[model samples]
Target: MTERKLKVYSEDEAKERLAKELPHWYVEHGWIRRRYRTNSWKGTLMVINAVGHLAEAAWHHPDITASYAWVEVRLMTHDHKGITDKDFQLAKKIEEVVQWQPGLEGGALEGTPQDDLRFAYIKYDKPKA
Candidate 1:
């Protein structure tokens, strides 16, 4: 099937949609962005891997930046040269996978049993005072 051209959301529309659908994410420059803070470097790696896998599966990639304790995901449809429904869809999927927790859906914790004891489960860090 031929690919339909992606619709680019206007700035106002993007902000409005994000406010309602993904309050945690904000429109910045030309991209919708959300930063997930992890407990440590190990947590950071876990987040990066999850995002990579999801992005690959969806064939909609996001610009990712990882640090020792956080991973920032910026989504925009490069071909459309703006934010599109594809961006929103991938962002939502990323959020779901990033926020998943062990035992939440009978899913086993990632990594070995010993690693589980040593590596802290990835979590969104609280904002600093």
Candidate 2:
């Protein structure tokens, strides 16, 4: 498979694009950034380590900072000197491995809410009881 190149975009343009790629997070300091707050430090580190593994395997890395209950990730193409599609692709993979649902990207990109929230389909975060 051919690697997808991240299309570079301006700061404002990136935000608009990010709405589609990552509705919950936003671009900061010219990188795709997200902050995750968990209940346990151990869980956070584990997730960070897992993400690190994936990044290395993909040959595309995201800068991650973790301590206590928070893990922050920043993705940008240093070679490109800005953001690119690689950042978005890695974000998608992270979402899958981490068991997270991308935030509302302004509007529906697929089927209904029930369809999007199919418990049988998602294995990460469980529905609140």
Question: Which candidate leads the pack in TM-score?
Answer: 1
Candidate 2 structure, TM-score to reference: 0.70
**Residue 97 in model 1: lDDT:** 76
lDDT of 2 by residue, 81-115 (tens): 78887788888788666654454334545422434
Q: What is the TM-score of each candidate against the true structure?
A: 0.81, 0.70
User: In candidate 1, what are the lDDT values of residues 4-83, reduced to their tens digit?
Assistant: 79889998999999999887899999999999987789878888999999999988899999899899999999988999
Regions more than 4 Å wrong, model 2? 1-6, 100-129
Ten-residue segment with the worst summed lDDT in candidate 2?
114-123
Cα RMSD (Å) per model?
4.3, 8.6
